[model samples]
Target chain A: MDLLSDLFLAKAAFIGIVFAITLGIAAYSTYFERKIAAFMQDRIGPDRAGPFGILQPLADAVKMFMKEDFIPANSNKWLFIAGPCLSMLTALMTSAVVPFGDTVTIGGVTFDLQGIDVNIGILWVFGIVSLGVYGILIGGWASNNKYSLLGAIRAASQNISYELAMGLAIIAILLFTGSLSTKAIVEGQQNGHWNIFYQPLGFIIFLICAFAECNRTPFDLPECETELIGGYHTEYSSMKLGFYLFAEYINMFISGAVMATLYFGGYDYPGIDFVTAQFGNNIAVFVGMGALIGKALLFVFVFMWVRWTLPRFRYDQLMGLGWAGLIPLSMYNVVVTAFGILIGKPFTAGIVGVVLLILGLLIHDQLFVKKKIA
Target chain B: MVISNIWYFLSGLTLLSALMVVLAKNPIHSVLYLVFTFFCISGHYVLLNAQFLMAVNIIVYAGAIMVLFLFVIMMFDLKKNQPESKSSLTKLAGSVVAGTLLVLLIALLRKNNLPAPSEVNFKSQTGMVETLGKILYTEYLLPFELISILFFVAMVGAVMLGKREAGERNF
Candidate 1:
């Protein structure tokens, strides 16, 4: 009973820490995005609030809270309220399965630095991310606005289309790791055995799909500001709109963490084992945690960089890429990976898969594009 | 004891949401209720330790299917077009058909003497992803492949139905 209670307490603490960090990172991501965007354009970003605009998120939060909470008269009241709440809920839920660090042992008690070490951690993240679509769908539809409805439909279709490619890409990695548990996947990446080394093509596909899944730029057709005039959240005001926006940042952060955990060496660094042997478990755990966060932050930075660099994709192009390009390429990667696993040459298979993917693209352009032009 | 309580709660919620799915007047509301029903059912799956099934249920049903339902519902301006009231005779016939089906289901269930209830083991690994994968690949491979073929055929059928020639209108 004592051990069980201790475990419960440890889990609760981990949950609290993860939740708080997720919110904090999400809040600061908005500020970071602006700074990154500004830097990309060669301009100084927010410098008003606190040092280097460090307090911008707080100011933004206060403003959001103070703004009038408006609901359009024609909207479905219950669903209108449920939308952002559901969005925030699902966005935060993915953190539960994400292992932040290696296990820490203190005074004979060991605890995982995650909310819950569920066996099907990756699937849980996928499931929760899939459900995130509902928040947008419900919000857009319930608003009773044409723009919102269109955005909602686009979001639903976009998510469904991209998820197939994403799942296939993940399957390639799963073939290498042979486990769905996030911690197990991270552990497998220890000693420089990261999945990216084995599944480079899969990683590229996964990264692109991750962008689409998060509704980030180039694929953010669902909420293209100029086209939809604020899109699904047009009818939302105050903290409700804040929730929708905040949810996006949280989704970005979680996906960054997931990308780090899956393809990158999550929390795994050179001499990590040596450090654990030398300095004790707690120090090693802290270093691992720092490395994991650093990787996720780098991914987050790349997400913003790409957002600023690329323009939103045309809707047809988005759908075509998802279905025609990524899906087939990911499928090819999966087949190549399967063959590799069978032949005891996984790395060779991955390299060949990448080459094949490029060749397939060139062949497709020649066969299809040449015909269309003629 | 705690597990049973959770089971009862989830079952109750599932039944309630299923009822609401039918009772809701608005099509959008009905779809939302249906999603709630899927969520409750997924909760039941979780309680039973079928975590993989629970995630799949939520992803496929509550996430994907319900969104499609909502998309279609939102496409039509259902707010202005109220449902027509059914005639008493039609209602009577519907009730009779439904009642007969319910009675037949109950009778069939009563006729079969189910095996005695087994002890509920909380630590069962039957539903784990690894175990399920092994069983599926070894024992259920044929059926699984057949199901994929079925889905492929359905996809082709849907595309055929959706496609229209230039300047063609079926209606």
Candidate 2:
């Protein structure tokens, strides 16, 4: 009874903390995005709100809430309401399985920073994130508009196509780590060598897929303003629109954390062992948590950087990249990784895999581009 | 006690949703209900301590398959063109076939003489990913490889079927 109560209390606290951090960071990401974009383009951004627009997200929230909530007359009312709700729900759900930090020993009891330490943590994230596509699909279908329908269809096809490559890429990392649990994977990387060193090709493929999954540029064709206006959420107004937009930022934050956890070694920093030896366990845990958050934030910044740096892909180009480029490349990565493990030279195998990937890309470019030119 | 209660609730919800999937007037509503049914079934898998199965079920069935179903339904615009009801003779034949299958299933169950329910070993790691992987590679290796071959054949068949004819305009 006592243990159960303690578990409940710890879980509740962790849930509250994670929920707050996810929402808070997601909200502020908007401000950071604008600021980053402005800086990249040589302009000051959102300086009107409190002190360099620190309160811009809050102001935006207030504005969203105050705006009139409109539903198109021909739209399916219930599904319209359910669309953004489902998006927000699935976006938030992915955070539950992600380990924010290693266990912290508070007094006599040790508590995990993750909300729930499900054994199949990575699979759980994938499953929940896959469901996030429904939010766009249903929202667009409910809107009773041709543009919205097109956007939703495009989003669905793009997500499903990229997910195949993403899953294949993850298989290579899984072979190296030999475990599906996020905690186990993170712990395996505690010896100063992150998975990125072993699975560089997989990381690149996974990063591209993550961008597509989050519906960010250059894969943000679903909502390309020049074409589809507002895409799936074209008919949404007020907080409904806010929910769809917020869900994207939240997805970005979760994917960033996932990438950090998978490739960059979650919460594992250089001299972490030294810090643990000098300070206590609790302090070390906090330091690790900070490191993880910093890694995640860097990934988020990269996400924004890419968003600003690249233009959107045309629809056919996006599909071709996913199916022809990534799928085959990821498959080759898995095969090379497996062969390497068999030969007992995993590092050499990874390097060979990367070399083969580059060679293949050049060959593909020469073959396909030359044909098109001719 | 808590586990049993949760199981009962999940099973009940699953049955209700399954029924709704068939009974719903709108095709979209039916797809959504099917998704709900999948979720409830995943909950049952979790209750059985098959966490990997639960995740796969959700990812494959609820996430991918249902999304495809929804996409197809959206494309058809069924609301604008509701099909006529089935003929009475066809409905009668379907019911008869379904009834016969149900009776045969019940008869087979009775003949099996199943043992009384055993207490679940919640702590057992039988359904863990590692255990499943070992079984798949060792005992079930041939069957697993065969399934992959089957999937490959199916995929090739689909691509063949879907290919555009020469000189045909896509539109």
Candidate 3:
């Protein structure tokens, strides 16, 4: 009973910490993405508030809080409200399965650096992400605006298409790791060889799909302001709008973290166990966590950098990527990689599989994809 | 026990949305209400300790199937109020039939003895999903595959129904 109580309390505390960290990072990412964009454009961004605009996110929060909430006259009032709330909720909850660091032991107690450890952790993450589309669909439909509705339709199709490829690509990863738990995947990568080296093709597909799933540039048809005038959130204002924006940034952060954990070897530095042996477990766990955070932040930075670097793909091109390009590539990766795993040559056979995939793609593009398009 | 409050809240929301689905003025509103009803139903599925089903329900029903409904509704451009076609006598008769069926269902439910829910016996915390998948793919694999083929045929039929012959296309 005492141990159970302690676990309950610890879980509650962990939930609080995860919530605060995710919400805080999400709020700040908006500021950071903007500042990064500014730097790329050779202009100062949001420097008026506090030193180097460290406080700008706070100011923006205040502004968002104070803005007047509005609903269109024809809107379904309940659904209009529910849309952003659901979006924000699903985005925030997905981070619960991500293992941030190894366990830390203190005072004869050990704490896992994750919100919840489920056997189906990867599935939980993917499942939660698939729900994020509801935000777009509901927001668009509830807005009762043509542009918003169109944006929602585009988003739903885009997300569903990319998600198939994404799931297939991850299945390829799972074939190698032979486990679906995020933590286990990280452990599998701890031998100084990340899955990205083994299954670079799958990693690239996953990375592309992750970007699309988050509705980032080149796949952000849901909120293409240039064309759709703010898309699904056009009818929203005040905190409702804040929720939409917050959910996007948080989704970006979660996807970035997932990518790092899945493909970039997570918090495993080259000789992390050696370091822990030299020092203590707690200190090593803390350092590993820092390394993980650093890696996650690097992916986050890349997300923003790509946003600035790449132009949005046309809707047709985006669909083509999802359907024609990604789906087949991912499926082939799955079949070959699964066979490799079964044959007891995951690393070596993965290389051959990757080579075959490249050759197949080259032949397909030259003969099939191009011919079909023409 | 405290977390149960959230579950209760979601359940209430789901029930309310279902009620609204029946009460809505327009077909479009009905469809929107139906989507919300799915959302709430998924919440209940979550509460029932089936996380996989919760996600699958949302994906298959709310995300994919409901979008098809929305698309069709949008294309049709339905009015706020459907035109009443049946007479008062017919409507009265229909109501009587519905009410009688409801009473019969209630009576049947009240009279029938239900088995008590089995105590939690599964070793895995994710009991429902694991068990369901085990039963579905193994013991019921042939039937499941058959049903899937049936669904494929139905989908093809739907496409055929939607398409016009080349000779009629110009017209």
Candidate 4:
């Protein structure tokens, strides 16, 4: 009983720490996104609030809190309230399985830094992420507006279509790891044996799907303000609107963490073993934690960078890309990976992935670009 | 004792949500209630040491299917074009069919004698993915492949239904 209680307390403390970190990263993500966008476009970003807009997110929060908590008169009141709450809930729930560090030995007892490292961690992520569409759907439908409903429909269909490719992409990774646990998957990638080297094709597909799932720019069709005028949250106000926006940042952060774990190596930086042997597990743990967080933040930067670089996809183009391009390519990736694994030549998939990508770009340039120019 | 208490609470929630799914007047509300029922059933699966099943159930049913249900239901302005009220004869026929189902369920329950929790035993690994995978690949390979083929056919059939005819009129 004493040991169980000790474990419980340790788990609770770790969860609280992780919770704070997730929110802190998400809050700063908003600031970083604006700053990056401004930098990309050669304009000054928000610099009024506390030194290069360091306090901008806090100011935004205060403003959101102080604003009127308004619901549309014709809206379904209960569902209107539930939508953003559900969005925020699902966004935060995924952090439970994300392994922040390998493991920490405290007081001679080992504890995982993650909230829960269940054997089915990846499945849990996929399941919860799939449920995220419901929040947008409910919000859009409850608003009782044409634009809002259209936004919701777009979100729903987009998520469903992309999820198939996303799941297929992960199958290649699974072939290598043969385990569903996030910790196990990350552990397998240690010592510079990152899955990215072996499963390059799968990584590309997963990255695209992750972008779609997060609804960042390019795939931000659900909230295309110019088109849908605030999209699913058009009828929402104050903190409700804040919830929707904040949820996106949170989703972005989680996606970054997930990508870092799956492709880049969670906490397995180069010389991780050397550090552990020299500095001990406790000190090494912090180094690894920093590495993972750095990788995740880097991903967030790339997400924002791409947002500034690319234009949003047309609805039809988005559908066509998911169904016609990514799906078929991911299926090819799976077949190539299966053979690669069977033949004991792990780099076979990587070589094929590079060649396929180049061929695709040439085809696109030759066929599509020439047609447009002519 | 604690497990039993949790079981009771989850089962109660499941039944209540299942009831709400049928009783809710609003179609969107009904779908939400059905989603809640799925959540409760997933909770039951977790309690039974079937984490894999619980995750898949939520992903497939509550996550994907229910969202599609909501998407379709949202398009209709149900209040403005209230479902043309059913006649008494139609209502009577619905009851007759539903009543027979209820009666059959009760009769089936009465005849079955399930082993008590203490009497039956199961390995903790029984429901885990690794063991389940081994059993599936070794013993249930043919049945599993056949089921997947059935699903593929059904998927093709759905596409057929959805494909627009060239001469079809558009609103």
**Candidate No. with top DockQ:** 2
Q: Name the candidate, 1 or 3, with the larger lDDT value.
A: 1
Q: Answer with 2 or 3, whichever has the higher TM-score.
A: 2
Worst 10 residues of 3 chain A by lDDT: A365-374
Candidate 1 TM-score, true structure as reference: 0.94
Question: Interface RMSD of every candidate?
Answer: 2.8, 2.4, 4.0, 2.6
List TM-scores for all candidates, in order.
0.94, 0.95, 0.85, 0.94
lDDT of 1 at A51: 97
Question: Model 4 TM-score?
Answer: 0.94
**Model 2 regions lying over 4 Å from their true place:** A1-4, A360-374, B86-113, B117-123
Sort by DockQ, best first.
2, 4, 1, 3
lDDT tens readout by residue for model 4, B17-133: 999998888988899999999999999988878889999999999989888888878878797967787899999999999999999999898889665666357578788899889
For candidate 1, the docking band is medium
Clashing pairs in 1: none
Docking tier of model 3: it is acceptable
- Winner of 2 and 4 under lDDT: 2
- Candidate lDDT values, in order: 0.89, 0.91, 0.82, 0.89
- Residue-level lDDT tens digits of model 4 in A89-155: 9999998898989678888888878888788999999999999998899999889888998898999
Give fnat of each prediction, in order.
Answer: 0.75, 0.81, 0.16, 0.75
* Per-chain TM-score of candidate 3, chain B: 0.79
Between which residue pairs do clashes occur in model 2?
A: none
